[model samples]
Target: MNGDKAPVRVWCDGCYDMVHFGHANSLRQAKAMGDYLVVGVHNDEEITKHKGPPVFTEEERYKMVRGIKWVDEVIEGAPYVTTLETLDKYDCQFCVHGDDITTTADGVDTYHIVKSAGRYKECQRTQGVSTTDLVGRMLLLTRGHQQRGDSEYKVERSRTESMSEDSAAKSPWTGVSQFLPTTQKIIQFSEGKEPKPGDKIVYVAGAFDLFHVGHLDFLEKARAQGDYLIVGLHTDPVVNQYKGANYPIMNLHERVLSVLACRYVSEVVIGAPYSVSKDMMDHFKVDLVVHGATPVATDVDGEDGDPYEEPKRRNKFMLLDSGNTMTTELLVQRIISNRLSFVERNQKKEAKEANLWKAMNADQEK
Candidate 1:
């Protein structure tokens, strides 16, 4: 810790099950207060014990948090019980948490340990948004079968059943034989046509709220990786459900247009409630799922004593490690903090120009 260098250590922790703007904001603020921000992700057992079941698995949660811009490293363990030993391990100059959790149930002040250690501060919570609000809003908005009546659901089920029956009836072969391809030549041709170079296929999907250069670079790399690049814009409802309420600064349509305008993206696909599913991958046959090298992979201990085994299951996914880049959340914070100064500077310039014009007019009249 050289006096001339930046503060090298900071500690922050959260459930981080769904990466949202609020989470990003907190991380950015924490990082700004220090040089390196070490994030502790709540393990599945810990989250389940304190809160209800998390929408994402522990591994997924870890990956989402790691993907954030300010997160220097992710500790995959229970964060609920923070100890002096843990704080000392990182040689952290301070421990940061949202101000929203400053009070206890009886209104007694909390976070005494960090304070005693001469390192504690609360970052401002992004107002009017949270994970709970997002989930509740989604469940309330969607029209369920119970409210619409069972007949509608039943009717849809019957239609699907009838369609299957009709398709089976049209087949020339009887029984299971109808399911098999009539000619082996067609199957061979399809198999031979596998992923080839120059195929104009596109791939794009994420909670891309605050668009930044990293996103742009990733899209550019994705486009270069394929003949075409189709971005999957997550819908507002889906985004709210997956991410917390304090997410997606831009709405679904805005997000769509943002990606559409990008030179790399040729088309856009709306991502549903969660991660890209097998159905979507199969339908698009995306040769690559381009991602940045921000360590967006969850480490889980396996029988072989390797933590990296879990993320490897996504074989079709290609991890493209882009250089360290700024994120939209960080950009927003910088703007907000400097907004007043920026406004005042602009106003002063405008006044100066007006005064110069008035003096010039007076001189001309003289």
Candidate 2:
């Protein structure tokens, strides 16, 4: 409560497994609607019983949710169902969620309790992206989805055409529509802050797809080394050329938002060059260039040249072991190992959402 009126505290809860720009967008909207945003994350056991095995663990999900820039607070181990008691406890004026539906294993709406009490609000879901969609891409090893070229138009075109006639079969939960990104969306997610003078600016570059706890840990350590941390996200094609096998589950713009959402990131170089050059270093005034424990890859031309040669020659390069061994490859493998479960989860989710839409349409027609 600031200056006579009680501050609006909004409540948002979910499994938040493999938290992406979609989740961040929802939380961003939630924060915009209120003074404070309190996010509740359900535990792994609850999520497994209700949906299926999550790509990330409970602790990972908790940390990821907390990393979202808009989140004011995080409540770990939240119940699968949203209840008035929970809202009362958090002093949240109302609960907010994406327009999509969330249900338990028995196919009951998790938010029915809050909806009936008129304490639930819905924001439009970010289309064309979801954990299910990412898992599907990983399992299928689809490489045609990477947005090529620099312009936003090309990016949107690539993503839209990436979806085929059978996209429904690919990921029922997320559908085929590509996530339309605009300059405004990027501006919205940006911190809009400049590095103070004498601030040691640290620059790190990577694919950073499906941003997980490992990336978070590395960024945290990098930020600890300097006052400002800038993450250089390589273009989709560069990543695919190096990673191969349908790398970068999320496209460039998607990766931009994901990295910008992190509290540790002060700025992001969208579609940054694969090689860290001297011009780039001088331009950003980067004081230190950091890389995770994972060894840097050679140039994309199949040459023996190192990508970090400039940083190393300048003595600006520093290798930091975040102590977390998690990698994007490991994450993809997790989904692959549980391929059947994820497929079933997507099917059931799509069915439930389809039914809900049908029921809503019927009531409206009446």
Candidate 3:
């Protein structure tokens, strides 16, 4: 009893997308407020209900949150309904939320339950940046950019040049490309050709370039919370539009292979113009949508006389922060900063190897 009482448990929720430093700071502060932190990740459907549309899918969001270092446990559910029932289920003595939610109309804030339980607290908002701010900045930086097209053209030309000599060579795997899936046969061997039903699918999407361990962990966690995990892969054009010109290092096909290889992922669907289509979700019978802790919720319809609200279905969304880890942008920056050193080291090694080969050939001739 004394041991249980010693560790204070806290509850926090958000649609953690992009999983940036601001989100990490928030989770760090939230964890400092209590001994144990249980995070809630909002599903895609719930996000659509509240905020317009999220950039990354629920799985991507979950992965981003789970990657955070401060998060102790992740709960896949809606963010808006931080109810007493949930608090009781988790045995949470304290509820934590950002100071920003203090004036919301839905008086049903996290502090309300914590105060009712006699242990409510508000964590400080991470200063400087947010997912929204980041997205806005990216939009500002990459708007009307033609660099992506140039990069794509360059990479394609290089690939063609490399393959020019092998044009007559037979393809390795029948007619299929190296990046394609193993087999088109969707039937399972053990189940004996049973038609797979589109069950209660949970959809999540993102670019997912430079796949990392955090990405894997999030997918595993999100898949456990649902029946099927449908990952939405952003096409090059879509990524260029949303993420800007200097984004998506790996092409769409490569990104798909990286995600498809994950055990938690079931199917990878390409994203449309923007946001996951409600029709696609309905067609797939998507029961829930999952996202990270810091996802940018755009397409707010409140000011335009549209029925859709800014943050849709606030109650049904779950915002999770599992742990903070590596990001693609950070990785790229590191590589760029060390480019000269890497090149010099590689050049030295190649010269040494060539000299040794020449010496060996001379000895063989003698």
Candidate 4:
């Protein structure tokens, strides 16, 4: 009978906004524990009512989770309150969540009901990386270089460790498999995975913030044009100069993983320049440069500026059809449309994460 049993179905659910290595690692661990790993993404309304304004919408979160190498099926609109009925509906034997405490406004644990029902399981959270830490980095970037006081326990070391953690298949998340560079990813982007004989190298650059279908489609099209696709991601400062208002909801490393996760993307330039220069082209041996149909941004002089200026002058520039593509602008507007609620949600989250971080520090001091 034991040999005849069907594969066990494991279910893990979360908001998964600002999907990162930590989330990926958790999913990987959950996946390793069972045969089939299905992730449930709570709806935006449920998340907003509970966790606060998510950097990414439920829809965006759904896509991001699906893209993770460890994830199998993704259930949209999973109930915020996980019930035995919810588990039964999905044919899941049990639910998995991180060890971190995620409670409600009234200090009610969301998983309490499920845990009491004996349908809950906990997974060890990976140390050194979290969405809260990343968000803090973004907020503090504007503070200019400042050092933490001797009395204040520093989060700097953890931040560096988190930053340096690879998001590819080699990440701590997946059990046996990690993202290994193909020749193209090494050559073009590093790039990795060396190109085959006579293979052309395609170059494209952008903020690629809040990476969406538009970015995916654009990258896919670019990949089709050449054997190797190298995507240059601009710095956050460069992105801000062009795309004001806390642009690039996700950071450089986050954006890098988002792009590198895409099958169409062969490699990535972590901090690529805003403008395409001759040296960059020669360095990467770029045969072509592609841009989406989105409008270009201007420089400090307020003059119309295209980053791909040199590519055009070299007659290697081309425009890809993004097909009514979604932009970071539209994505931002969606969150902004619910601005008051979103802002309040973020503030609450900041306060909560801050308190938790402080408590952790205090415990360590003790």
Candidate 5:
């Protein structure tokens, strides 16, 4: 608990549905308030009663929360209605929440009881993001553009259809999502080890955003070229420079896990530099630096620039042909095309859950 600064245990509770960077950032803030951060996730029924069904199930939400690097502990099936009792049970000094207006089904402020008890703390809401905003991005992607009759969406959609058979449905997070990753698993995946003598270290960098089969195939081919593979993921802004217009649908953290889950990937460099520097090559003992058929980095003025400048200087640069043209743009278009399928899937899930909820309530009454 950070050298026992009174061992503050801070608690935060929420549905955390469709967990994303917004959720991650809030947990970060909550953890900053105390030594130990404990997250409480409400059950599906409680959420359904108050906030409607979450895109991901309660179990899914629980697992996602547990995976965030900031989370210390997670309270599964926490009560939707917070109480001093719950906070005391966890030894949590205060309950933390974003500065958003959250209300119950009856439009009552949910944190009233806690606020009245003088244990409520509010964290700044992450601007430009929310589960609702993300959901809208998927559902109403072609909204304003549709009204304006923009041709780019249609063009991208058609281009995506021609590329591959893989479909994007629901949130892309659910597509490549994995069970909670362990420290050992992460270390092993990241290859955070001293390289053995004669080990051929290959370095590659990109957004690796949606993490589709193309990424798998590309990594497989890259892995075949070296004993260790280090993938450098550019930051979101840098990715946007090349990807353009609502690209990198996943944030940097999400993209990290997505790439880490790849069997062929040895290690991932979070917020890796766009230009491969000599220092990086020396540190990792990278023998080969590879770039795929995607766009290379550009200078601030927008002219094309060498992404592998240091690698090139050291004669360690090479271009790889993974022969897979699939990209995140294509994946997004696939989702756009299969939009109705996902909507129907959600509808079915809601109906099934509603029936199950009714059955449980009836049994309780009996």
Candidate 6:
């Protein structure tokens, strides 16, 4: 209610399983069209019945949606189908989604009702990434996608170049695209705030691939420890060097946006050093450095001792349990274990989308 004229509330709903920067980007766009953004997350049962098994549970998906910076409210266990009644109940002026297909198991568009009522709008889908593509990368163990470092100049190059050449060979449903990153996009996602004086700035660093509930929980706990929480996002090459074997499913720019979108993050250090040096700590005015319970990967070449040595020496380091043991490795195993299901799911989804496009085009021709 802006001066008696109601605010333009926007509604966006999805399963949001394996939440990524793509999802964040969509939410950001949806929010920009209205004063308030209300995101509805489908539950696990509904998602499994309609879209196949979700990577994350309903509770996790709900929490992840709430964490997105642009999301003003979250409706848990929302219906798979968007109804005008749902919108009117929430007083939303319109609903929004990405320019991608979302259908039920019976090949019905989830937003068809809203579309028919002229209560829906579409935003550009972020290219080069999707849950299906990420699952395929895990199932195929595609190591070439990892960003590699050119030691001579300390520069990094994305393997997506080579991967793009072979894109024609891949299924349209699961094919990967080269993610075009821009400083403007980064600026849009960033909080862009400096820590105030007397503020305790807590720091943590990681690859944060997949950006699941585990990362969300860890960030929440870390944020509780300080006035401002600055996350250090390691470069893709650095993550690959440490994790080795098709690691960092998301690239550096992707990971940067993912971390910055989290509500718990006050700021992020892009391409942060793997080793937290004294100079680095002093630079951020970091009062404490926290690490999750997962075993720390050794330094890039193992030539440098422990990565946390500087923090340890300064007595500013603390080990956080986070309670949830989920990791990116565990996520890969989940995808690999259910490879056939996800593969079939992507194929069916693409087929349904193609059929819809054909029908729509035929109508337009008529």
Cα lDDT tens digits, model 3, 1-366, are: 236467778888877755554455567777877788888888877754544355567877776677565678888865555667777788887677765542112223434555676666776654433443333323333322222355654453344224323333221111111222223311210112221575556666667765655566667667776777777777766666556566665556556545654556777775432454446655666666666643443532123231212124433234445465656666555444655443332233233334445555699999
lDDT of each: 0.54, 0.85, 0.54, 0.68, 0.68, 0.82
Q: Per-residue lDDT tens digits of candidate 4, residues 14-116?
A: 8888676567667877876777888989887887777766777677688778866567799999877677887888788888888876766665667888899
Clash totals for all models, in order? 3, 0, 44, 19, 0, 0
Predicted model with the maximum lDDT: 2
Model 6 lDDT tens row, 97-207: 988778788888899999999999999888867876666567667554455233411221123223333322333433466567899988988888899999999999989
Clash-forming residue pairs, model 5: none
True-structure RMSD for candidate 2: 3.9
Best by TM-score: 2
- Give the winner by TM-score: 1 or 6: 6
Alpha-carbon lDDT of model 2: 0.85
**Model 1 segments beyond 4 Å from truth?**
1-3, 102-110, 142-366
Indicate the worst ten consecutive residues by lDDT in candidate 3: 185-194
TM-score ranking, high to low: 2, 6, 4, 5, 1, 3
lDDT of 1 at 173: 10
Q: Which lDDT tens digits does candidate 1 get at residues 275-355? A: 555667668776666656543322211122322222235555666755636565554454445554433322332333344
- Between prediction 1 and prediction 5, the one with superior lDDT is 5
Q: By summed lDDT, which 10 consecutive residues of candidate 5 come out lowest? A: 169-178
The TM-scores of all predictions, comma-separated, are 0.44, 0.91, 0.42, 0.63, 0.52, 0.89
* Candidate 3: residue 347 Cα off by (Å): 4.5
